[model samples]
Target: MHTAITSQPLPSAAEAALARESSRVLSACLQTRSDAQQIELHDEQGATHPVRVPVSALRLLLDVLTEIGAGNAVSIIPIHAELTTQEAADALNVSRPHLVRLLEQGDIPFHKVGTHRRVRYQDLMAYKQRIDAQRHEALDALAEEAQRLGLGYD
Candidate 1:
């Protein structure tokens, strides 16, 4: 019953627009994926929406689905648990260098057995939580600012 998104505040007009645009683009992309299986989203509020997108549709959605589904609310079966540096970076929605910085910061624990850095499943989940929280905070702040300025989505 865990969600990637934490409720703090609403999203701003710009954030909403960006999300809408991204959704439109993603919907188009998902429509194009031959293997994209429509996923049915059942929100905690008892709302349900169906979308069929494959793992290759984009890295983020795949990771989200993986995270939610990995826990008590496991969506689909978990994919790769142990991933390489590039793969972990892709999953974290960041570049390799950024992930390395996170690794150095100890935001995510990694192992260097030999010359390769390997990120574990638990580490990836923690990183996702941190990333999601920051996004939520930014969107919340942006929305509040927009409201204070009388900005409208229309």
Candidate 2:
């Protein structure tokens, strides 16, 4: 199923604390060598239920919990999903106009449906990775230049 891109609010302090504790417990459980793991869930009425989940799914849950524990908002988008221009912009943390410019410049590819532009999640991620790598390379170069110049940036 394709999930629409949406912004999620950061976890509240109480929720963050609970997530931190839950992540810690789940981390311990994930250290087992089993392919699947059984975990217990406790309801408000003090009823306990056990559920068996694939280790991969458990690892994903742990990642979500870890982000929430750090008070960060998290959104899951399937790799095959198509996003609207605005959604793609939001994913890149850029303005829609800027993203449109990138699309027009051919820095990223997009397809149109009924006059609306749609970007593939995978393409957007590829573009992001490319730009991020370039940025890191530029930064590393600047740092090297600074060290060579004896600018005291040791």
Candidate 3:
């Protein structure tokens, strides 16, 4: 999968300031629907133009800008992009061999591309979400059991 990320150098001071303001504007704009979701862009020539962007895209842009403002590295990978087994394993924070076993057990779906397996980014995300939810549920159940046994306090 192709990931879009900022280069090594983080955003400049001015860019960080702009990112803060843009984050506010994008957050506010996403909460309400206007006739057009537009933002002004200023070019090096000092010319300003309005550009329309989808609300979903604006949300992502806002998140990226916020992360950059906080001096964090950000990467955007398309949900539909295909990833190699190693890449998928990295995404899941699992070993490549373990990931392959999961694939063999039909835990995650995949497709073969000329003898090489490829997993969609969306599928990986889905599996991660499911696992996270299951973990949360199990934790909650354990907490409840502890409370019932007087091991947990209010």
List the candidate 2 regions with Cα displacement exceeding 4 Å.
42-48
Clashing pairs in 1: 12-143, 37-52, 38-51, 38-52, 39-51, 69-74, 69-75
Best by lDDT: 2
For candidate 1, give the lDDT. 0.65
Task: Pick the TM-score winner.
Answer: 2
**Model 3 residue 134 CA deviation in Å:** 1.4
- Superposed by TM-score, candidate 2 places the C-alpha of residue 140 at a distance from the truth, in angstroms, of 1.0
Name the regions of candidate 3 deviating beyond 4 angstroms: 1-18
**Residue 3, model 3, lDDT:** 44
Error of 2 at 129 (Å): 0.8
lDDT of 2 by residue, 60-143 (tens): 999999999999999988899999999999999999999999999999999988898999999999999999999999999999
Each model's lDDT: 0.65, 0.93, 0.83
Error of 1 at 123 (Å): 1.1
Off by over 4 Å in 1: 1-80
Could you estimate the TM-score for every candidate?
0.46, 0.90, 0.79
Candidates, ranked, TM-score:
2, 3, 1
